[model samples]
Target: MQTGENEQALRKIIDFTRLLSIAILIIHFYLRCYHTFYKLKLTHEVVDHILLPLSKTTAFNTMLFAKLSALLLLVVSLMGSKGKRDEKIRAKTIVTYCVTGLLIYFFSSYLISWPWLYMGATSFGYLLFMTGGGLLFRMLKLRLGGDIFNKENETFPQEERLLENEYSINLPAKYQLKGKERDSWINIINPFRGTLIGGSPGAGKSYFIIRHIITQHIRKGFAMLIYDFKYDDLSRIAYNALRQYGGRSFYVINFEKIMHRSNPLEPETMLDITDAMEAARTVMLGLNREWIKKQGDFFVESPINFVTALIWFLKKYKAGKYCTLPHVIELSLVDYKELFAVLSSEPEIEVLINPFISAWRNEAYEQLEGQIASAKISLARLSSPQLYYVLSGNDFSLDINNPDEPKVVCLANNPQKSQVYGAVLSLYVNRINKLVNRKNQQKCSLIFDEFPTIYFNGIDNLIATARSNKVAVTLAVQDYSQLKKDYGREQAEVIMNIVGNIVCGQVTGDTAKQLSERFGKINQQKESVSINSSDTSVSRSTQLDYAIPGSKIAALSSGEFVGMVADDPGNKISLKTFHCEIQNDHDAIQQETAGYSEIPFPSAVTSSQVILNYQRIKEDVKILVDDIVDSL
Candidate 1:
């Protein structure tokens, strides 16, 4: 009862003070206006009684105190009587408003002589402080609470600014920020540093990312070598892009059709017998991927050395006229004695084959056969008529980036025959990497789709070193597990880490988790709400979390991609990471594709002619063996 009585007394006092301040303001305004405009002069009695008692030192000062008292009374009334507590308002804010208002009102004393100027300035000051200060507090509250509904930290750095240049591939994209969609771009500022694209099938990796890379790089006149693992899908794109973009030379090495043939072991490009040893290493590892894990094993080294001796022998035989894969396969299948006899006759490789010779002389034929059998068996799988016709002829050189005659080359592999076609394709990839990764060559791009279908021995090294040589390599795979399964874990990790740009679509398991960790973390806000029968409470908090969660990566839509890119020193990109949907003009691409013509056959050669050519290569190998034996 006593507390209620005290509250009522305080309310009465506040109301009386408010009314008294209003009356004082009215009296001061009226007296100031009448004296300033009408030139009214007060008698001494009126000045002493009315002006000195009511107006104090100045009418403006009297009005300022009255208005300030009224504002303070309102604040006191609210603070003393409240139902729900306001989390926004604090004692500090109330004190700040009071001090700032007092300073501004006192500073307006100079305008007191001009009644109109004083009133206008006071009114402006009241509106500016009270109204604007209230709004600023409200903004502070909202910022502290954050956007709890959309929990993502959309405060990421995103810019609509795009950087384009002769060596760049700019992709149009869009991202979300605070529930608003904004335009963005994935700027491949320096593609020479290499790009790795990973996603599941139907993830739009090829449709959204790879196709753009192909068309744009081709448009820029880059001598390209594309590995179409699914055959004509990318091959057709390469062909049409070449025709539309005006390339100097175009070639496709496909075994299933009338395709151009290029020797992977071309003599002028192989450089030396060590190059042959490298080729042997690549082919042996490609054919026997399990051997990648067992690289230093004697059996593995034996086969690689045997194949090297054969390749170097052919490269030496008749000035390398027969230094082709078909010839190598034919010679590898020859009798062990004759093969060793013919290879050992070459003084350069005598020591290379001495182990086999010692085993043969000692009648340890089983041990000798064990070493040579793997090579013969692996090389035998590639001994197809179509494969021979494709790999034996020298329709063009492997140096596609020869600036004088820049070539746009696409080599295709059949999915049904990946094992057979993969070996030959790996050889091409190995050879082309060596040729294209040289100084002063035409700027080139090597795009490998379904990269795990074939093995690239030094793919990590190529990506690491190719940037300076102007060779852009783009590798696409279904998942990191596939890469680990095919390329071995150590090599797969090296390839994954070496690339400068990475774009990924829907993927799950370790791949998604790995990508999530690669994207790093950002500060994000989370809200929790609790309700009881009597009351409800809400709380907000912030913590460092994955910018793109692994679940988000696993749940990414078809056209959505999340990745980071490299930037050149001259063309720096501040926001290198992204989670965006590549905006492709489907209508334009479809219409353009509709106008594309079929790739023309370079010759009128028939399947029977291909068979005849295959037989002739075998006959050449047989006759060469005979001549070498006769000379010995």
Candidate 2:
């Protein structure tokens, strides 16, 4: 008797636990429905009245009605319970009850009396009921329908894991870059991918790049390398600001200074292969000192370093042995020690080393010589306070190691000089690449502004492979035409493809067509008309034909852009433009230019003025035509 009583007590406890679980699930379902309804504004009477009420019920009545129906289903389902067979029946019955309740509620709301309460509840309540029913049905289907839901499940495995470490970093919204969508400045994924800013010469491409550096990258403590080949007044201003931001340790290279170097062998004209080789050599040597110390005796230079391994290969080439950088790079991995020994033995290697050393030594001496020469020639000139103020007005000193404050390094000099803008860019990229590759740092962003002018040979390779090393590069270019003009069509395409993100601003003509094709197809329509008539008695018939054909490419506005992300290459996201506050660099330049005297000459008139003059001439032609017409 005692055993029987204990068994009965355990059975009651199990039954109560099951009842509590079911109650919790039901409550959760109702709360989800309520939340969804609130979000969609479906609980409001105003919307229901505007669309015409579907029923005479209140939102509370509709909710109560659903609950009562569900309770009835539960009671009826439990009353029929027998065993395991009854459990399956009960699950199916509950799903059916929920689904029927939703259908009945929607039909009465939309097709029947159109009450304000029913209309409001219909929007979100119907959605909730359907979702809950679907989930329950799926669970039942997985158990009883031979795992049909399991077979059809398409959820990604990785998505099930929590994203605890994926914190988002916010960017300031009021950047004044020009565009709507206040939320547009939020965390951007893969910003280093190529972004194209298109407009005419005065369309503010340089301005945007400078702002990005100062406000976004530098201000955030991330380093940036800019190559401004146009040598615009804006570049000079940016450089000055960078100098102030990053004290004396800040490295600023001017291409004009390289030309002024005492080395007679260094080419004074356009940058050729030799100049690139030299620049690469200098950077490699600088990097090698640290690499060697880190590796100690085990240090074997890879051909990618451009110093130890590449020098060895270049030496062989001088002695009638043919080789390329790629070949040396390939062999460097296989026989690093042998290559390092060969590199150390090369006599011709000294030719490259000597020039770099001489240039480095002469830099300070040249600065001293200029000071001495200026002092001797200008006792009176130096005494003039105004002259001193004008000549020595800007300070260019920066300390790079200050962690508390952000450092800004701006190349606001002539970019055309291969050594200054071009060399600095190359060195900066190489530095970051080495740091990431050797040390394995997971976060670093490199921004290359005005990219075309600083064309380096291996930039494409870097873009393609740098992601693996955690080095991200953002290349900002004016247009596709500019890229093609700078790097040729094939190379340009290769470089563009390597980048995973493409953001474009206003573009037209060939570029527009190209971008449109890349983003996806645009929908077009045409209209046609036909008419026919027949008479039984007179056998009269009539026919008519009309046709219209129209087609238009996708038109993107100034701040509007078509964003294509590589992760979802097929998806074309339309992003609102970034609004950036306009800086007064242009205004300052205008003021400075105004101070200079202008001379008038026949040849000095601009093309725009010449077009105006031609228009004036055309006015005479128009007068002649008017006289001829009058005479006729």
Candidate 3:
């Protein structure tokens, strides 16, 4: 009871001291004002005795009473402030206030001569000092909660970045950058440079990032080719977006259901033997990804050259009248002598088959069979009626970027049959790449989901050169190791380096480390404290550190993405990199998708028609073989 009473008495005295300091300042101001207005001395003995003793510390300048009152106010305020909720103020804050207050009290006394001017100046200086000291206290007292290692983590400015051009696609985003919550954008200012999206499964690669790219590109009227590896997942989005936006053209290539029938080897699409070679190489590598590492091996080159010769022969014979993947596959299964003899007649194709022909005539049957069997067996897998019917007809051309008729083509593959379909789909992708890369075409986007499932031959060349053609390529893979395994290390590295934009979520191991390194480093403040029985000390230092550490990337939650985007010269982005959660309207998307209409089949096919189509292709191949033998 006695202690409580003493504490109450002390609080009263502190309050009294504060009031007395304020009263002194008010009295000084009133006297100064009167002297300035009336031009008479208002001095008194009581004022001189009270303020002169305080002024002696600073040579008794004209700012005498104002300086004394400021000092008194500061002292009383500090004494009275136990801080709200009884929280103790930091020692550094208290010391800063003390030093700053004392400096203002003594320094203001020497600066002003007139009583009125000195009084106003000293009072203004004290107000400025208190505000500055409060700001410093807040800064010093900032607390680091949650992860300590994330303290001072670097974050670029999150401003609404956009090119606002017809060719660009911009996405809205939100983030906390430098302690301020900001709403911003992930602007693909020059999307033609290519984009690579990577993450583990369920990391929102399709949900947060790719979906936006699809919808935005469609909105901008880009003729697009989407490789939907999970069949209808992305296909549904493309179909619905097309309907919503009223796209000029829409088509789907699927083996199971009603699909658009188009010849991947349409004569105009494969302009020369080189186009055929590219097609053959893409197909073979897509089928046997292991062979990508052994590209120059005898067996690998032999099969590729053999397939190339067959495609060219079809392209030249009857002016590419019978040129289709089914025709090439059928020709591959014919007797080697008939096949080689027919191929040797064309001088352009003879050179490609000389090695095989030499092996055949020398009675090196084992080598000939080995050379031709690789392509024959692989092509044989794609010989079913469904693929034959699909690849043989020319329902539409691969020129998706045609100005007169821009098209949105979605080529979907079943994960269960990815190995078989990857080769055929790769052929389609390669052909479309050739078609879209011509100058003066409409702007286009080629989005490949599960990109590593198909081997995109000359992908490096495409990424390096296609920007001028306004072709935007987006490749999404689960991991870099998948690219290395499927596309070979050298080419995989080329693809990774050639891309201008990269977005990632929840990737681990070397992928996270590589991305972390790519994000680079920043100067960060690090604090360490040492304590002993005698003393406690804190040391602060700064060093370069990863902007977004690998561990943080590996631990990212769903919808969180870290990436850097390419910018255009006309509209530059000062902060191209980002660590953010791409804001999406979940309810809105759900509502939109909920009303989606299924992609209709082009025409219904019964079991009998499927069988009839299968037999007709076989009969055509046999008749062609017989005609060749009869002509010979």
Candidate 4:
């Protein structure tokens, strides 16, 4: 009995609230109408001598009545006293009607005689009031209707919302335009999961990448690991100089220097490799537990772990003391058969360890030997023991160790050696992922300037999985055909599926087609016809047509391209061309080239030597031009 009484009381309260709201609305309507029409004497004046001298006054009256009827209908519709609140409030329709009424009222006033021009003036005033009132009411209804009714409400699914947020990093406003302000600029969205930026010899791909590194990455304090394959590329040296002279804090790992070190592969010397191995171990352990649960108790422990333990066991056995944490895991030919047998028994485990095992068996341990030896020599070579005191006294940290501080590391490498580039990129990405995952940070951006050339295995997995881990990767590539050529059909398809955002510039060929299909949906049209014969026979025909699937990549001007986010469906990718002005630094170029020398001859050489020879020519040209001016 108490519950029923409470329910009744609640119902009564709801009823009273609704009644009060309706009463307030009615009072407002009455006050607005009375103030606009009655007190103003608008209706009386309109019916009196408004259209007096015209023989078509009746027709004019009918038109005025019709327009006023529309205005009233719009007001009543907004009141929502009618049932079925799910109906959409047609604000556009209401505005159209109000505008039409205003037009009619103005034209009708022209029919009034000069003596009653006051009526015309009154009519004009009422027209303005009605039109303004209709527009204000319509706008309010449109804004508030969604809140009042469930039918009008809309929201994105949680996963899609998260994807949009994650993919928002590639959004042009975030990283594209920074430091240098411009009236206009071109933004190319790397649609490929990994993009490769390549062009004519002097197309400025590397220059663009370097500019981004210096301006965006370095300035912002994000860590970058550059593999300087090109011996001539000055980004690495420039970064070092910037740190020394400009007080820019950055970590530069000159892989060339590391490669040249006596024992560059040592765990202590190769910070990148050390971090990668540790990450590999963590991934292996996770996979091991998952495999154990899925395959049941019969599943054997991961052989990688067993091999690791066996290495420790062997180290302990040889050292004449218990194995410690520093005992490194190294495999040899003797363990090959056992490794293969274990891998065969557990194929899933093989997926995690195969690459590491391959690296170990092939070059990792030998590389470690070189690295370890090099560290000792480097320590020995330090002129000041105090500098060594800072280095040798503490454990070396990862390239991105200082999370609180921003550090930019440049991997300045040549693009000619595709495999080497791939290896370097894979190593850097693996290292960054480890650092980010370990720290469990809120956000980090991985910008790969030219992505596709460096084809790292499992990059697709990284794209799909990294978002949840707060790592956003942006890949800038030239075109789709380049990706298809390097990664082949299957891997490229896998890559495309993983990335949520796609920004494309002017493209041609298969890439353009693929992008068009992916970003632009198919539009279909249908036509139908029916005929009845004299003999009472009926016939019908129907036809359907479809626009060919293609990329929205039309031939754009130099800097134009289409861009799209995940949620937007139609015509969202449309964007004007962005023109980035290339800034000249003559003084810096001169200073950098001061000590640089040119090769004596480049008459006969391989394609790989072109970039090097080109640099030499540039230096020689500068010298020759200076000499000519001096002679003059």
Question: Which ten contiguous residues of candidate 3 have the minimum total lDDT?
Answer: 80-89
For residues 1-632, write the lDDT of model 2, one tens digit per residue.
54988767865665664464345334423343544556766566664454223223342245455444544444433443322222133565557657765666446444324334444555445445544443453332223244342221211111111111121122332231112222233233444443444443444445534344433443344444444455434345444444445432233333332111111111221123343344344333222322212322211222122333342444354341222222222333323233334444546465533432343356655543332222122122212222112112123222222333323343434543443234334444443333333234333445566676553556677666655544456666767778776667777778766666555545556665665555543222222222234211112232321111011112333333333433323323344222222234567656744553321111232445434533443343344334434544
TM-score of candidate 2 relative to the true fold = 0.37
Give the per-residue lDDT digits (tens) of candidate 1, residues 1-632.
55988878976776665555455555565555656544555335654467545555543455555666645654444444322224455546655765676566557667888888876766555544554344333322334355543434644766578889998889999998767789998999899998999999999988998988988999998999999988778878888888888956989898888579889998888777789988999898888888888988999999999999999999888899999999999998888767777897788898789998899899998998898888899988888898899888889898889999999888888889887788788999999888889999999999999999898888988988888899999999999999999988999899888889999999999999999899888888766655555544568888888888888889889999999898888988878889988999999999988988888888877989988989999999899889888888
After superposition on all CA atoms, what RMSD does each candidate show versus the true structure? 10.2, 26.6, 11.6, 20.8
Higher-scoring candidate on TM-score, 1 or 4? 1
- Judge candidate 1 against the unseen true structure and give its global Cα lDDT, from 0 to 1: 0.82
- Looking at model 3, residue 274 earns an lDDT score of 94
> Alpha carbon lDDT of residue 59, candidate 1?
37
The residue-level lDDT of candidate 3 at 559 comes to 89
Please report the candidate that would top lDDT against the real structure.
1
In each prediction, how many residue pairs overlap at the backbone (N, C-alpha, C within less than 3 A)? 0, 22, 0, 30
lDDT of 4 by residue, 1-632 (tens): 54988767865665554454344323333332434455556555553353233324442234344335444544454343222222234666656655765665546545434324434543554455455544444332223333332111211011111122212322122112223333322222222233333232334445533444334433333443444445336454445445544433444333232211011112332233233333333323222323312322212233334333332232223241212111122122224334334333433344544544665568666643342332222222222212211112112234343455434444444555444333433444454555554345434455555565454446677666665554445666666666666666676667665666655555667766766555433222222222233212223333332122232244433333344333334213344222232343548755754654431221233444434433443343344334434544
Give the TM-score of each candidate: 0.78, 0.37, 0.78, 0.38
Give the higher-TM-score candidate: 2 or 3.
3
Model 1 stretches with alpha carbons more than 4 Å out = 1-151, 529-538
> Model 4 lDDT vs. the true structure?
0.39
